[model samples]
Target: MDFKTVSTIGLESSPVAQALAGLRANEARYFWNKYKHEFVTEPAANNPAIVARVNTILGERDTHFETAPLEVSDFEVAGVR
Candidate 1:
């Protein structure tokens, strides 16, 4: 597979970086082994459309969440969104 394994989120901070990396690796391994798909993640700041959609859903239910997300990941396979 030609995919990058570690997530870029929270890498600058020392405390959580290792744990996050392990989590990302574990998720990747699971998908790769079972579904033959690469698990990838991106910073939430980079995905406006997804953020908007999530916020819209939250609005419909009148729920209040924290201001921003630390990271956001999309789980997809076979080019489906």
Candidate 2:
């Protein structure tokens, strides 16, 4: 399975803006892998077990974001646009 993701956001600086940005990217990756099962499986559908597993994995990560927008797009069948 193949998945493509795109993210766009605007950030406001307080003092440690760069550090916070790095932290945010790390968290994004963390959540990306945690919730990637839905994108990696065939026959797109919701699986409670898979979601539970994702939640479990994310629960182990300790990260915080002041304010950030997130988006998750799904496209099961990919062909010519």
Q: Residue 19, candidate 1: how far off, in angstroms?
A: 0.7
Per-prediction TM-score, please? 0.55, 0.32
Question: How many residue pairs of model 1 clash at the backbone?
Answer: 0
Model 2, span 7-71: residue lDDT tens: 22322433554554555555556545865433322211344455444456666785344532222
Model 2 spans > 4 angstroms off: 1-10, 37-81
lDDT of 1 by residue, 1-81 (tens): 123555545554545676767776777787788789866667677887778887898899998786565556676676665
The whole-model C-alpha lDDT of candidate 2 against the native structure comes to 0.40
Estimate every model's Cα lDDT from 0 to 1.
Answer: 0.68, 0.40
Worst 10-residue lDDT window for candidate 2 reads 1-10
Q: Each candidate's root-mean-square deviation in Å? A: 4.2, 11.4
Top of the candidates by TM-score: 1
